[model samples]
Target: MAFSTIKDSITFHPLGDAAIVIQAGADIREEIHERVKQLFTCIEQHPFDGFVEAVQAFTNVTVFYEPYTVHQAAHLQTHNLSPYEWVKGYIEGLLEEKWQGGGQVKRRIVDIPVCYGGALGPDLEEVARINGLTSEEVVRIHTKGTYLVYMIGFAPGFPFLGGLTEKIAAPRRETPRMSIPKGSVGIAGKQTGVYPISTPGGWQLIGQTPLPLFRPNENVPSLLRAGDEVRFVQMSEKEFFSMKEAER
Candidate 1:
């Protein structure tokens, strides 16, 4: 594996046609999340010729690009270069220059409203019972903690969040739910995530947000982006219904 540091971030050279993984840290942490966000922003603002898209994951950002376009570009074609090598070199050079001057990118924190422990949150009681905490206590801890958007995966626009309080951590259900409704808030092991679409899942359901997670018709399909901060604000069932109706 080839590794190089750019600014405070690190890039990894892995074999892949569609993308190369640029890792910011060895493990998942808030700082790493911020760094990854910064790098993503940097690339987006000053994208290379063939850049297509980026996939943000736990500790890395995978950059996807068109190899043919990159290979044929005037600035990149001089050397008989492999697509992977050319892209890697270009990113490394860009990072070294970008970080020479001192400045940091700021990430935004988003708050989502959730209604817990009712018909909306059918599994909330189960989760609370498993953790030996009262239903109210579980909601308190979940809301009190600040979560980081580590990645957007599992399904389109589905945000895999980190930094759940251990007081509410629980394993996935023995049998996965046949179909989980969209916007379902769930916890599995130490990770917490929101389901972006109606799909089958095994995560312990606790609550759900009325907001739409993925809307393909909009300019940005996903409501949440990687490297963003998320906080779940508790709402009453009435409030949830109000918000849902407002969206209609």
Candidate 2:
């Protein structure tokens, strides 16, 4: 299904009985991300009878709803289409309207403090060695650019970011680590992200953050959300320890 001619060509795929994926595009690009976020906002602001929530990703939004609620909805009874078909039509109609109405939304920028290299970053030297860059050069280049919070997936609060400078890009480690500490920052290819919880991962560890990214006890567990921007602020090991001590 075509949402608009202005870069967003949407395609729908059924995700079981109660959900569907609205794919705006196939590639990883900023415009596509923005469009995805806008669609998310539109759905949140003006949802249908059974609308529950939308999960964001690279170029898609997975919308979840109650099938029973939709099946019994009075206004929707006139439509002969099944719940899935009606929901898809609802999204497509909104997309068409948003395109004609010039839909635009603001995003938030978040600052992340990181202490690059050293023991905190076990593989920092390896990344530099592979890229033919000094550790300091790698740090400078990594922190210089602003990254987009493309989505929150993989683990709980793990943010899939874009806009990592190609110069510092490095492949994931050949062998995965047993247990990566929470708040560890790493880069895999052109993607840079932090470990929100202890998990096995292979991204080249560059540093660790003291800030908590996931809090299960909170109403909204994830520290960051889709459509937010992130800037990494470099700090010294001394400062890291100081911050940790203060948090304790």
Candidate 3:
């Protein structure tokens, strides 16, 4: 949805006993996404008494909290509303306080080297054929496009990327594979992503990247996060293996 709609359009609903979801707007537009980031950051900056964590998605922020503590918080005594109402009001206040265009959401540009076609991208030819283009042209278009990390879900560190070129878009495989190797890039519908770990999936295979997407031991476990910009670059198989060895 547009920025003007944000004033009275936000919907605050409870996600269960201990969580609340604040929906800013609709659609997958950058404006709504940036507002999501802005609201996420606002909550992070001034965490309430029982606030546990907040998960930011394309258009909403799910806030987890300790219900007991939140209900008993001395600061919330002024509001006679229930815990859900109290939290909603608090977030609404924050929106009014800090929602001044939100500015440009800070984003990190991550470069991903992908070895496309051949065994790595078995569906590359099919995807190209569906779009009436050669595999080389498909790779060129995919590499030229800039993607946004809308959210990380499905698997640990598996980024749900936006901004894939519509030219090479294809449907998911009718039958999903039991084991898709980690770093395998795929496209389904208008979205694209990489498999952070071996798992069952049906997105049409496009390429593979050797970079580790998740590192639990590190301070930031996921290589990419929501709002980050991703640019995929084509690489030769020889360079891909060489870089893999260098990383190891």
Candidate 4:
């Protein structure tokens, strides 16, 4: 059954009792991702009454809210509208307004430092062989491209980036590793990402970063967000060690 449409480009459907999913478009294109991000930002800035958080994926944004507070809102109570229905209407209305305003969301560029090859990148040679290129060439191609932050998932502060160069594209390992160190940079298929914290993964290990992707004490835990631009800056082993020491 058809639920509803927004801007003739997206489909909105109920996710659960406390959340709704706005499916904007198919594919991981920047235009659609930006729209989803903008809609999420708009709702965050102008939350109804019980906004919680938003989770952005490849082409959808999941909005979570407190139904109790929403039902208690004076305007909603007076209108005798169900909380879910009111939220759905409000989001659809926002989309219409944004379309009329010619909405355009700006992307943020984030630079990350990486120490590639050698011990830092154990699978560097394998990645190069799989792509039919030298280790140096692989590094050049990987670093030169500007990647988009498609979504942040798997773990807190972990960013799933897209737009990797074809020359450096490599599939994930057949057998997943038991433990991957934190700040590990990896490539799987056409996407590249960093391991925010130490955990198991199938992505081919390429390098390691000194950046703290997740810090609970900080106001903002995640270093990267959806719709952000990511660039990999090559660093030396000495530089990586120095940076790590400095952070300590």
Worst 10 residues of 2 by lDDT: 1-10
lDDT of each: 0.82, 0.87, 0.87, 0.85
What are the models' TM-scores? 0.89, 0.92, 0.93, 0.91
Higher-TM-score candidate of 2 and 4: 2
- Candidate 4 clashing pairs, residues 3+ apart or interchain: none
Candidates 3 and 4 compared: the better one by TM-score is 3
Q: Which stretches of candidate 1 lie over 4 Å from their true place?
A: 1-9, 74-78, 100-105
| Tens digit per residue, CA lDDT, model 1, 1-248 | 11234444475766478588888888788767766776676677778878898767777778998888887773555777778888888777777666422345456799999998777788899989998999999999999998878888889899888889888999989999999988899999998988989999999999999989899999999898886789999999999999989986
Candidate of highest TM-score:
3
TM-score of 4: 0.91
For this target, which candidate reaches the highest lDDT against the unseen true structure?
3
RMSD (Å) per prediction: 3.2, 2.4, 2.2, 3.3
Candidate 4: regions farther than 4 A off: 1-6, 74-81, 98-104
- Candidate 2 residues 1-248, lDDT tens each? 23556534778988999999988788999888877877787788778888899988898899998887988883567767778888888888777775433455577889999998878998889889989999999999988989989999899999988999889899999999999999999999999999999999999999999878999999999999988899999998999989978866
Clashes of each: 0, 0, 0, 0
